[model samples]
Target: MFPTIGDLISYIFHVNAKVNLQTFGSCMALAFAGAYVVFVAEFKRKENDGTISIVKVKTASKTMEVIVNACIGFLIGYKVVAILLALWQGQDPVALLFSLRGNWIAGGGLAFVWGIWAYSTHKAMASQFIHPYQLMPYIVFMVAVWGFIGAKLFDAVEHFQELLYNPVTVLFSRSGFTYYGGLIFGALTYLYIGYRHKIKLIHMADIGSPGMMLAYGIGRIGCQLSGDGDWGIVNRHIKPGWIPQWAWAYTYPHNAINAGVFKQGYYELPAGVYPTPLYEAVLCILLFLGMWMVRKRLRVPGAMFFLYLVLNGVERYYIEILRVTPKYTLFQLSQAQMIALLFMAGGVAGFVWLTGRSYFSSTKQIP
Candidate 1:
């Protein structure tokens, strides 16, 4: 697996471009792209079903459009120009990108020129209904912000000792994110945004179910590729002939985390561990496809999402069996396992309640 774009490029082109295009970031970009596309299609589908109405503005100002576009352009150029300059100077692209260094003058100058051009060319158009898809970028931005904060917060809590010893490093380091934490906080934030936009919470949840699953699957690909300490317990057992060795177990050499905990005579780990992340990626992708296929047929507003929760919870719970994680003494279960149980129970309760309500409503309507 390619941990970074630099590694992939080096192997493909035989050139040493020591740039770090993190696999996690790449997968996240892909996940967002996929989610956006799926969201647009789902939004259109809902419109066709007459479930939601499009709102049209009487008039829109080209000035506002120009200003927003210009701000976006400026932000992109501000960071990108600096990175490009560093690359040209033969500096490590990743290091330079992450550092507090940039060609601000050039970036600002270009942004100013671009903004002027955009303003001059901009024109006000006839009023039209605003598509639900139009709000996707804002929704995505909110989710990302909340998700990142939640991930970091939960991770910090999990590794409280590390945070106590090295507060700055633990907080600022580019690792130790928890997926469930991100999901809970991000979902709450997304729901609030949807509610503010006068959207039905259940419908919004249904719309996001499949895309979220797909994103999770893609994110796991990043975890697997980077070997970010998400692997399962060490598998000393011999692999069966039918299964691929890499699939059964893996010695993550040159892992992105550079975790060289084991030492027999060498610096690197001597044994292979279960590739749990790979398993999760595969399982989540399959779940995503299944949910996507049956989404339209699930008439109940919240059924799809609840089903997704159940499936996701089950997958995580089972995977925890093979994973190497600290466990609570009460039930010999890991923190994730306990969370998974809660997710499963909540999903079941939600599904039953919704289904029962739907049944009662249908029965009452009968002649």
Candidate 2:
């Protein structure tokens, strides 16, 4: 598994590169891109159905534009200047970027110039209002940001002992995000945004269903690629002759997190474990396709969304059986499994209520 693009590029070039283009990050970027495309399609469909109004962009005041541009410029300039300086100094670029080691003078100067350029360009361009659907990218971005924060927070809670011992490392580490945490926080954010924009909550949820599934599938690919401790327990079962070895079991060597116990002679783990992440990726992708196909035919606005919850819950719950997570022995389930049960129940109840309501309403009009 290639943890970073740098590793791949180094293999191809036969030269070591310091750059770390993390596989998980790359997959996440792709996930967001994919989600945005689906969001745009769904948004258009809603607009065509007269469920939402077209969004208009009004010209911003000169001061407002300058302030916004300046803020953007400052952030860009800070990171870019820091990275370039690190390269010049032969320092670890990633470390420098994450640390408070930027050249403030250079960053400020670049920011001033960039802000001026942006402001002038805006003034010269014709201002026009765009469709609200066009803001899907921004909405997706915000969801990602908040979702990550929530995921991290939940992870910290799960491993409270570890957090207490090394708070900084636990909080700042790139790994250890909980999927359910991300979903809950991300949903709340989406709800607020939809309400603020006057978009129907149920309709927005339906629109996001496919995208969310696709994103989860794509993200799981990263877990497989990086082997960041998301694998299953040791699988000692012999593989059938017809079955591929990788599918049945895997010994993830040189994983990004450097997980697993070393064997007698090898630097990598000797025992093979179930590749749960790969299984999840394949399953979720199939589920996503199924949902996409039936989205339009679902008819009821909230039906698709509820169905998604049910599918997601079932998939995760079953997958948890093969996963090697800490279990709540009293309940004979994992924390994720408990959450999955809740999601499934909620989905079932909501689907029944909505479908029944629709049925009765149609019958009333049948007079």
Candidate 3:
């Protein structure tokens, strides 16, 4: 299991670049980038078909631009000049970069320049038409921030003991995130943002659902690559002749979590566990493709999103059977399974409601 880019590169090319980049974080970056592309294209397609209504959003107003851009400029100018000064003085630039050392004049000048440029840009675009997709960047940024917070908070709940032992470590750790928490929190944030922008809830959900599927698929690939302990219970079943053995089960040697028994300067599971992350990655990617293909055909407002929930719930519920998670003794089900069932039930009800609504409305319109 390769935890970092440096590790993977060393194994393949036998060279030490010593890159500190994390595999999971890099994959998440790619996931967001891919999602952004999907949003851009999906919104444009909806706009062209007259399905999306353009609203006058005040996000790019002169005051907003000036304030945000000035802060950005100040930070950039502060650290950059400090680093340059340190290098000239034969001191450690990296150390200075993190310190309070900075050139105030340079920072102030850049801040003014940045603010003026942003204000001018907004003023120039005042008369031109704006697309509804202009809100995508802000939506994505908010979702990413709050989603991470939610993921961490839920993880802390599940591992309360660990958090108590080392509060800072557990809270800030890059791993140990719960996906469902992020989904719930991010969805709430997305809804609020959509409301602020006057976007229809159903339309927003439909546009984002497929991209989210793709992002999740890509993220699971990271979990598998890093072996961050999201694997399944031990697999006793023999591998079929047609399938790759590692895909069926893996010992997860040198995992990012450094789990399993250590022996002879190595760490690995005594026996193989089912590679559930890989399974999820494959399933979600395929499902994303299917969703993308079927999206245009779904005439009902929220049908596409409801379909997403059903598909997501079904896949996760079945996979939870193989996964290693704490279970509720009463129901003999993991928390994820319970949530999955809710998603599936909600999806079915939503589909029924929306279909009935459209049918009744159309019937009433018929003279």
For every model shown, what is its TM-score relative to the native structure? Answer: 0.86, 0.87, 0.85
RMSD of 1: 3.4
lDDT of 3 by residue, 1-367 (tens): 8877667888889997565456777788888888888888888888888888787754566788899999879987887777667655655453464457788988898999999888877763554446878888888989998998889887887787899999988887656799888888998898888787778988888888898899999999989988888999999998999988889889998887879999776578888999999999999999999999988899777888899999999999999999998887778988789889999998999988987898999999999
Question: After superposition, which runs of candidate 2 have C-alpha atoms over 4 Å from their true positions?
Answer: 9-19, 56-64, 80-98, 103-106, 121-129, 262-267
lDDT (Cα, 0-100) at 206 in candidate 2: 90
By lDDT, the best candidate is: 3
Least accurate 10 contiguous residues by lDDT in model 3: 90-99
- Give the CA lDDT, 0 to 100, for residue 51 in model 3: 85
| lDDT (Cα, 0-100) at 64 in candidate 2 | 77
Expressed as tens digits, the lDDT of each residue in 330-354 for candidate 1 is 7999878888999899899998898
When 2 and 3 are scored with TM-score, the better candidate is 2
Comparing 1 and 3 on lDDT, the stronger one: 3
lDDT of 1: 0.80
- Ranking of models by TM-score: 2, 1, 3
Give me candidate 3's TM-score against the actual structure.
Answer: 0.85
lDDT of model 1 at position 270: 57
